[model samples]
Target: MPAPLIWLGAACLGLYASNKANVAYLKHHDIVDAMPGESDQKSIPVNGSIVTCGIYGVLDHTGIWYENTIYELSGKGLVRCVSPERFLGNRSGTHIYVACKPNNKVLANCLAANRARKQLFTLLDYHLFDQNCHRFVAEMLVNHEVAVTSFSDLNTFLSEFFDVPIKWNRALVKK
Candidate 1:
């Protein structure tokens, strides 16, 4: 066999091996799997009735959902409000894990305040390790006296500090 052909075969094998390893790592870390037609909408509370606060992502990305809108500080240095259909849609490969659903009045007030403080709410301030999307969500929830620590600390914080039930929903990945 030609040397170049042998090297090409080896490279293909290496790529396949690395891909499998990546999938295993993601699963070990509890990253939600992407199945066909999966969706997060089922877990979302009825609009204007309950505020479902939670994070949605696999391993590489994550965002927050409040009421009907999903908010996240994108890597582009902006806080974006994505529609539920876009956020949890099959195109994004994101999932929803409801940490807590607070009272309707409380959620309404939070949403109102979130709208009123537009400057603070949609600021283009993004820090990956210190002040990322998770931090933004945690701050907003904490300000409303709803306990949440950070993106990675979600389940533990919600379980220990709040009485609201937690729910999970997996969104589909676009093929």
Candidate 2:
């Protein structure tokens, strides 16, 4: 092999190994400047663009503004920073299937039980906020299309479950 080509292959391998390790760290952490309520709101700013570019493309949602080049959200609920080279690999199109093993089963049950209310709620009925099932189950979704009317109820719900003032929620309404 040519000297230059051999060095290129070694470089690619090094980058790939580095990215795989860093992704695990970025996915589970909130960046330094992130607001407190970002997790509950489902809004996260990711520095990794390698993963996010394809995520938006898959969801058909765009106009995403960010400072870094590789900021993208993966289907697994992992918002990550992607490298320019790895950006296209993340573009498999379906994000609904994440790490949850029973996600499909739970979602299916919910759709069957409540014809009116769509997604998540049905699955959450059987799931709880335990160590095993803490990630996806929402205590309340409050969608206008299906009409979940409760500012008071929502506040009560969070307090009872989380025991913290979802105090940052106030910031969302200010503007």
Candidate 3:
């Protein structure tokens, strides 16, 4: 076989194996898979729900849902409230996903929302691996400082907070 073909095949196999491992992990933890491309009905986010949107189809940007608005930390480090359109703007996907229970009911924490509201317009030293959106959202949910580098970490925190399996509900909250 050609060298290029062999390399491509190896990469494909590695991706498949990685996906399988991730699926098994989620299932063992009672967590739902909510990666982009999954079919989900559009709904509105409830206050205090942890919401996320895909970025470049490879990453997810997280925020807190409150009063029909999303509180997110911009890359520039400013925490601000944004409409759903703004949240999804210039992103790879159009739908926003919220944390939910197995019954599809949205899970929320008012204290988290309050924390996010209080932190509005606050500036932080945004570090992609540390004080980024995932960490910000996780801290709001937990009402304490935490280290969350990705959606999986945030979901783990939320699952423990609500004591329920976390699923993602696709929502499109409008102004």
Candidate 4:
């Protein structure tokens, strides 16, 4: 084995360890699930604003549930309303976060209009780092003044910076 190979192996192991630690932290905090359906779905208010955030595998996906429809950007590069069950079935160990705020009629209308517009449902130029599911959710929420602009900032807001209420299933530990 060459010296370079040893370094590469070490780097890979480090990355793996870091990911494991992050996952563990999330689990311990009761923010993520270890398996599918491990967490229960939180109820969305009928007259308030809500954003449903999900983590599917390594991908963090999010959507807004409005009028009983879940709007999200599909892998096919289109924004569409999908059934909650279908969305959850896409991946195991999915974690959902909901943020609810008062008087979000404007945001609700915007989402409804976007869903109705065929033009907005076109191909999405998905970029993993620059433009992804998280970005999409952030954009929608920010436009409605429900969330901060930056995704990193929003994470902080979700965890600490905001007075808005959030709901999620309790983390379950397997025996």
Instruction: Give Cα-based local distance difference scores for all models.
Output: 0.42, 0.26, 0.80, 0.47
TM-score for each predicted model, relative to the true structure: 0.46, 0.22, 0.83, 0.52
**In model 3, which runs have C-alpha deviations exceeding 4 angstroms?**
1-23, 33-42
Q: Per-residue lDDT of 76-146 in model 2, one digit per residue for the tens?
A: 43334433344445454322111111111111122211222223222222211121111212221222222
RMSD per model, one decimal: 9.1, 19.2, 4.2, 7.9
lDDT of 1 by residue, 13-112 (tens): 7856664565455335544232112333343333221122222222224445444666655656677766656654543443443332322111212543
Best-matching candidate per lDDT: 3
Candidate 3, backbone clash total: 0
| Candidates 3 and 4 compared by lDDT, better number | 3
**Sort by lDDT, top down from the best:** 3, 4, 1, 2
Clash pairs, candidate 4, are 36-93
Off by over 4 Å in 1: 1-41, 46-67, 88-97, 100-121, 144-150, 170-175
lDDT of 4 by residue, 27-115 (tens): 56644333223334433333223344444333345565655556776766677776566556566535444443222211233543353
Task: Give the lowest summed-lDDT range of ten residues in model 3.
Answer: 33-42
**Worst ten in a row by lDDT for model 4:** 100-109
For each of the candidates, give the backbone clash count: 0, 13, 0, 1
Residue pairs in clash, model 1: none
